[model samples]
Target: MLEHNDEIRRVKISVRPLVEYVYSSGDIESGFRSVAALHEGTRIHQQVQRMYQEGDLKEVTLKTEMLYADILYQIEGRCDGLILLEDGWMVDEIKSTSSDICFMEEGYPVHWAQAQIYAYIVAKEQGLSQMKIQLTYIQVVSGEVKKFVKSVTFSELESFVWGILASYNPFASLRLDHIRRRDDSIRSMPFPFDSYREGQRKLAGAVYQTVKEGQKLFVKAPTGIGKTVSTLFPSVKAIGEGLLQQLFYLTARTTTRTAAEHALGMMQSKGLHLQAVTLTAKEKICFQEKVSCKKEDCPFADGYYDRINVGIMDMLSNETLMDRTVIEHYARKHQLCPFEFSLDAAYAADAVICDYNYVFDPRVSLKRLFEERKKKTVLLVDEAHNLVDRGREIFSATLGKAEFLELQRGYKGKNNRIHETSRVVNQYFITLKKECGEIKRKLWKELPEELINKLDLFVQEAEQELQGIGHGDAESRQLLLNTYFAAQHMIRISKLYDERYVTYAEVVRNGVSIRMFCMDPSFLLAQAGKGFRSTIFFSATLSPLQYYRDMLGAGEDDYSLSVASPFHREQLDVRIEPLSTRYRDRESTKGSLVRLLSKMVRERQGNYLIFFPSYQYLQDVYDHFSAENSDLATIVQGTGMTEEEREAFLASFRSDNPDTLVGFAVLGGIFSEGIDLQGDRLNGVAVVGVGLPQLGMERDLMKDYFNHIGKNGYDYAYVYPGMNKVQQAGGRLIRSEHDTGILMLVDDRFLQRQYQELLPEEWKE
Candidate 1:
């Protein structure tokens, strides 16, 4: 047990005062508690203000801190409201409650503590001796309102706040001690790798420079350079140097997460006593086979905040690397919600390993981690090129009329409010269908603002009805909840909608739907890059660094580094067959492609991978080649390969006494990147076509849009994305210095100057 003092008080202060008490355990119950509460409150407040023209309410302030004893002892709490009292000094605390406020009496201790905290802050700030505090609780389910008001002297409020602070000080002191110890441990940690490779050293140097300059860096380093360790080693050093306090290793896929974990483990093995946690998606990490995230059903979720502190303290004291297995072990032991436990652990972690959504997606971004952009934190976006599409999907929203119609029918008799709200949204979709003239074709234009405004109005009504219901009607309640999220998503997307987005309507089985599809995500990508302390976007094939930098939101002021592949030029046999595999020429070239691919594999007596633009193309060429070369073993990518199937495919590529093995895989699929086939496990790669995307309205529209922006529209929209797949396919050939392989590009376009210019320096003749 430690004694708490004024120094502990200074360090223990909540960065987000209003949310300090909410606890990380609350996140497991249902997403982010503080953000959810704030969102719900804002929604209700907006509705109430629209209905009633009372004196307008305004934000008082946030994270306001007041010194009680010099700079050591302080009182801080975010003021949610500072009501303009026509006469008296009134401090308002707006609360969004799922439970019926009428069920609670006037003197609930939780309510009192909340109001008292606000009153103390207002009284201190306004130089008032006494203040009237109002606790405005709006039922999130019912839209019913309740108010609890009381007047207390500044001295009394001070005493009440001091009591809460006294209890919190013990926890604060413990956290500070832990942080100091962790930082001290990190300071003495050694570089995990015995020797850094040339490429690794270059990448590490770039990361350090980026941090030193406090600017973004886009690095293009080939695979096998130990990208994760190269980036992590430098980032951790930055932490030791007090340049950064936290590092976020964000990845696009699960397989990549394992690589990050492996890298961290290497560092840990090298005596780095850092606290790092890898966050698994809530759906995957949930203890329950299927997660509902309701309090009654989940013992871990019920009263999570009540036990979270103990769980957090216990884990912090006993563990260093809180990986999923460690987290699950601790969570089960302490009866803590594992999903929420991971999030809580992340806040205290020196580094976090997780998916891109944890940082980039608005719906799922770790709100607590990014509260202050200027905070000493660094984001290492892994496989960053994936973000171009992933970001668009995250920021865009789609609502089908079918789901609303089903909800309307489901809730018609039992839940009138919910059913009515569902009907309103359904009607809006119906109106949208009418506006689209019953066409099921893709549209290439901007979404109508008026339509979005109407949807906004519908969102308000649905939110109010959902709030009125609270948590009673399970099925109908869920429908409303889904609608609420959809509406919120639309609201976010509407803000970013511009010429880059194409408005398209589709009709499927008598149902008409409209979408504000993102034709190109470059502009939106640039928007997300803003306000970060720094970002490093690096990949093996950011070959034409200028194209990636331009599309990846790299500013002119942002630094760029291109590290060449360390492997000797002699190791890779790069060949370009001037064969036409263009969409128009596919029929004529199909036989030639199979013959060319067969010859490449026969010449190289080892496992080979043939990458096609689509499953159809892959199957077509695979069938033709398999028919001709029946002696060679072939594995083809199916609609969805199970774990066993994927294993069998890789296992076929034996390293010892390797035979001719050809695996047909689609470009830009899972097999393209992250998989390691070192030495003789894989030898040659034959990439069919330029790997351009299928001719779709979206791709065409993207081409036109970029052409309008003073760029080569075809390359921007089609050629580059296609070439990315081509490059990724080619990258599979080389795994290590000992690995010698051939890369055959089976497309005439690769021989053209426009496409040829984009080839990596090492590949150029």
Candidate 2:
């Protein structure tokens, strides 16, 4: 929807990010700042706009084009109100704040700057020699209003607008140059691979055509068909053709993010000049041992905005690929928070590789992506099978009574308001526990209005405390902050709750817990993906296409493609052990399962990965197998392995190893999918049991909910998800055409009609 002109080298930007960037100064905000909820803010805006005069225009769409530094800038925005003043036109900008407006004698520079831009645009277009600008501030809770007005000549307005443009021109120019050269390279570049491996061309063509038409494409691509490149290549071509300005390669796991980065690297080596940024989670990339955003506590958070533009310019000018290492280098060089720096850099990147949370999670999604940019953006969701569960997590939230109880005690003598609010919340939990009596666990179709009201009050008190009314110790402060975030998240999710959601309460050892569980996330996912030009959800394990389509919010007009496996069927030697590895039979069959794994490894004489349904099962069999074999080389996956430990585990599976190496892992784990160990590095894989999820309240709720909606509830909640993991684990073997490996499916369920039908075509006889 942006007015982009390739010939004119025009840069289209919204009014907000531009002004914020130009006026951005000082430190990254400290941990606690009062941010009104989105809906609350919108309500306040409408409340103010309702007072407009008969001739005054509210939500006025204003736009103007300016030539600055020989680059065209198409700036557009909706002004809060264009007042019909007695003297002339007055451009109004409304801002809602939690703080009192009485102390704010004048308005913020950023607010004034925004009003001035709208005024200038209106003045230039209407042939007015003068214009009035107004800053309307309303205190959110009290509904108190404060207004500041200024009048400037048309020449003065023009000068001010030009200065704003000049400050932003450098960034726009940098992006413009990158796009020009990137497109040039893309126009001449061929596919990165030597040739399309069977289904690759079809997938690539489908992606390109889907993007061109601005629709969604769901793909069930088999493993080893170059799914990454097949998707990325066509998206890159779309960028070259001006069909898209940016693409987000969203993955469910860190390993898959690496795959996307590697795919882009492959294209870059072939002269593709696109600028791509890989965003690592903040916890993994922060320079400090403990992440404290307080300016005094962390050097990187101090005056980050002051140095960020320079850092971004330096990185973009010198490097085309801004991965973690490159980002950290520039971040340290410029004294910037690496995570924040990457986000800033990503705004200008042609492609962004990051986790699905960054794009889909409401609490974490980037707010700076304006509607215009979104209309030109595409989301390529990788390993999409993981998104079903991830989507549920994204739209759900939990609140525990323990945090409130702790806060109630911590703040009792220090602050009465926080103490009282926390006590009230804790007391509500106690009463809810009494209501449950013996059952302990309860579910409801409606929201808990009373708890929500109490949590809202607690959130307000907590926010005031965090704003420095009364200070607490570091530990107390952390607990309060964590509780504040949880309360806010719960409130946010409550707003999204509908018939597809359920409210559940469970009593724990010490206290009670409640969660707003999103039983089906299809509606929310569809809402989140609305503005994008196109979305391509592809995974090697996105089997049972219709099930995924319904769960992933597929539209009626959306296209679905099921690409056949590019690898030959003869390459895989499949076998069914026909053993009982179910939960009830696990102890009875542990010995037989151990022997089967030992025999497979001994027979193959190459590296083999054995996957179990859970860590306990993996350990049980590993203990028995080790007791019998003793001399066999083995490594077992530990719980919560660090990145270095994981690397060491995989590195042990080198192709040059002299003897056979067997790795014990769990299905649907970090090792099960998104890993590539082609050729001699991995020669066999054995998946024990049908990878069914542990039976739980949430899964049962999902099954019941889906069945109520006239679908196979058990399959929707259990069977399909379990089999997806089996497919993903088996997929690790035979990554390429030349690769050959043995696949062993342990458990009698593998031979069952239901499970057999769920297996991938290549895995079936």
Candidate 3:
């Protein structure tokens, strides 16, 4: 006979009554909630810090529970910090609130119950028979302190804990039921799609085989191949096969997350049962603008673990795809900290659809997933090429002397330790600035390891002081938080710090210092790629597969696939006019370029997009073309266009009784890739120049670097990137089998063998 699982056994007795009885709970928007509390807290804290002296404050440690377990049976329910106290054993829970705290009385049963749990744990840990537990509430505004205390024996505390547990059992039972069903569903689930495309099949087979064999596969499938579903479907099947347990669908942008969600929805519709979650960015998803994770500032963050287990159980049992809306609904229903709850839920999920940062970024990788990495996990990287740039930003750290100088001034008179640390960091930057000799930019062949080491020591001291404080002291807290993030960033980048990265310090102004830096992300990306069982990097414009594969760190053993465009070659009228539009030739060809654009618009009856190499070029053509054919409706790209404006720009193109709608946009900008202008809505694309990035120091350095590596320096630094932009822009013209459009290359470079060889077979003439 099969016995109940450990989770089932735990939930049976732990479910509490209060959670058991609630029905049709109101949904609290976590993002808004966090933002509100952050705003209020930041405002109040700023005022308090301005008026208060750091030396006047005393550090307090209110010992509550040594081991506190949630009444909910989830594995994440256990927490060590029950209740914290300031000096005089005054239990303090600092809360930042956007609303009145008058409704929360001193002896509220729930509040006391929570405090009692903490007290019980603290007493047991300290071997005390009785203790006075104080509930100190700090009003976010006015900095008012309200203290409530009650003396209770260990027996009373035990009774109170038991009561809370009894109130929580039903919700636990509901969760267990869902988990059992979800696991069962996953065990029996089949391939969701009725039939897979050829590219989808090949990619899926490779992913599954890789997971089974415990190796890596690098795939380059083109667009329209349903890469998301292809990758997800197999990972789900792997779950059923007991070869893998979790899948992380990582992407570069928020827009891509929806596609992952949609793919999961498709699987769910086919009777496949699994938990899939999309993690919104902390800043964007958080209800509060300035997020401080302590309970006193935000109720959602308060006693977060107490209700988290029930929240997780509730969500997993009822929903398959825990997208933002669904997660928010359940979080509100159970009064769980939505952000933390989402993270916890992700740990238990079968599939996690999130940004690449969640998995690859050292500063933000999910801690819980570390255990799942080896057993059964596969990473499906969408738009893998974007990882090249994204990885650099993630692995790079920047620090300014001005920030440390400001901090030194803020703490100089009172905190010797903080002041000394800040001074040390400030002086280092000063010395670095002096060495640069008034030049804003200077590169070091090697990283300044000694400087980094000294910074690390300072970070260690700051962290130690921060840990000692426990809670409160707004000014010190902010300083510590800033330093902590800085330290974390440095620590993350330190691992990848090498000769490939240029370490340069710049002087912004007198007494103001900054560091300009760059790290070769390829090696770091390769490190991230190693943890996954396999990765499929598919895009419409990965024309030069070797370039992408090399930069993405694909090994020789990794499989590569290139699918030919499904659309007929004849459908697109590809024409390359050998007319120079280079930077030097622009002035001479200005008239011809405008004439060419005007001619394309006149010849094309419907929607058309003309991509320029730079914003200046785009504006120049827009001005000339508008002056020549002012009557034609046109939208030119600006530095920043709101979502509504972008929608309006695309909406101007109509399929019925077509009128010429010309849009001028920079290559590789917002209008490129991800925007779908299927069929008649878009009929043609005219690309100007070679789309090379401006000739600058960075480009020159990259060229030199590649030259040393025995590769084509110009191609690596300029031509490849330019062509990538061109290919992506050209991809917009053909989206489907029936879609017919015209593609005109306005630059003479495309006619050259070097550039022409880089073109896709379908575009080669």
TM-score of 2: 0.98
In candidate 1, stretches whose alpha carbon ends up further than 4 angstroms from where it belongs are: 1-12, 15-19, 22-77, 81-90, 96-115, 121-131, 138-145, 153-159, 166-171, 434-439, 442-446, 449-454, 457-480, 643-648
lDDT of each: 0.74, 0.89, 0.67
Q: TM-score of every model?
A: 0.88, 0.98, 0.75
| Over 4 Å off, model 3 | 1-195, 289-296, 464-480, 508-519, 642-658
As for TM-score, the candidate ahead, 1 or 3, is 1
lDDT comparison, 1 vs 3, better candidate:
1
Residue by residue across 74-102, what tens digits does model 2's lDDT show?
Answer: 88999999999887799989998776567
- For candidate 2, what is the total of clashing residue pairs? 0
lDDT of 3 by residue, 548-579 (tens): 77677777787666766656779899989889
lDDT of 1 by residue, 464-580 (tens): 555453533666667666766776677778778877777777777788776777766767766665555667787887757787887777778988887878888999999999999
Model 2 misplaced regions, further than 4 Å: 1-7
Per-model root-mean-square deviation over C-alphas? 4.3, 1.6, 10.3
Clash totals in order: 8, 0, 27
